[model samples]
Target: MADGLLVFDGYCGFCTRSVGWARALDRRGRVEMRPYQEPGVPESIGTDAATCADAVQFRGPDGVRHGGAAAVNALLDTVTGTRVPTTVYRATAGLQERVYRWVADHRGRFPGMTPYCESHPSECAAST
Candidate 1:
């Protein structure tokens, strides 16, 4: 089963919204949602709490882990109303990490963001 593992912050309202968005747009049923805050979640990705803390993570069909902007870019490939940006995103990979970092650092300015960012960020910074 080639699943798209979507790692998110269980406590964040914005992160929850992103999960819902993924479910709504993921008609292919390829994405799996997991909250990094859970006890066994990080182990699933072979990562530690500190490393996984600030970003959303994705494990693709190959079992390769992708975090930060790349993970978000990968998610966009399968989600709706996200294809266009995905293309643009591909062209701007050089800047994606920086962008994600900025958002992660200051996400509180945006409402519904606390769930994912009392300290860090990753809300579909990946895709659709």
Candidate 2:
């Protein structure tokens, strides 16, 4: 878990479950998972809550930080050379940002997930 820190939305059902799934498959335990809401969580990884709320954040042991799909690539690229995320990161020459935005915008649509706004109306209003 020293290799990387992955910060995700703890309150989000989908995001929480996704992290659980990742933990199950993380053979080497290289990625440490933390929820953005936990006290002193993101700060430990050198990221702020706002940044983590907007996109998944990955902070490598080398101190490099990457967000969204790029964050995923930071974790999966070397271990799984041709994984779907890395492939998307490579294939989308110019639209990767849009993809991340879309995913965040529609995150509530994922199974078991409620829109951030609907679930935490006050928090979502502040974030947006």
Top lDDT hit: 2
> Deviation in angstroms for 57 in model 2?
0.3
Global fold similarity of model 2 (TM-score): 0.74
Flag clash pairs in model 1: 12-115, 72-126, 73-126
Worst 10 residues of 2 by lDDT: 119-128
Residue 51 CA error for candidate 1 (Å)? 1.9
For every model shown, what is its TM-score relative to the native structure?
0.74, 0.74
User: Cα miss at 126, model 1 (Å)?
Assistant: 27
Tens-digit lDDT track of model 1 for 31-128: 77777776667888888665666888888666878888888877766454346756877789889989987876765565674454334335323211
Instruction: Report residue 78 deviation for candidate 2 (angstroms).
Output: 5.7
Residue 10, candidate 1: alpha-carbon lDDT: 66
Query: Residue by residue across 10-119, what tens digits does model 2's lDDT show?
Result: 76777866776777766777778777776687788787888888999988766888888788777675334335766778788358778778877887777755433345
Q: Give the per-residue Cα lDDT of candidate 1 at 100.
A: 88
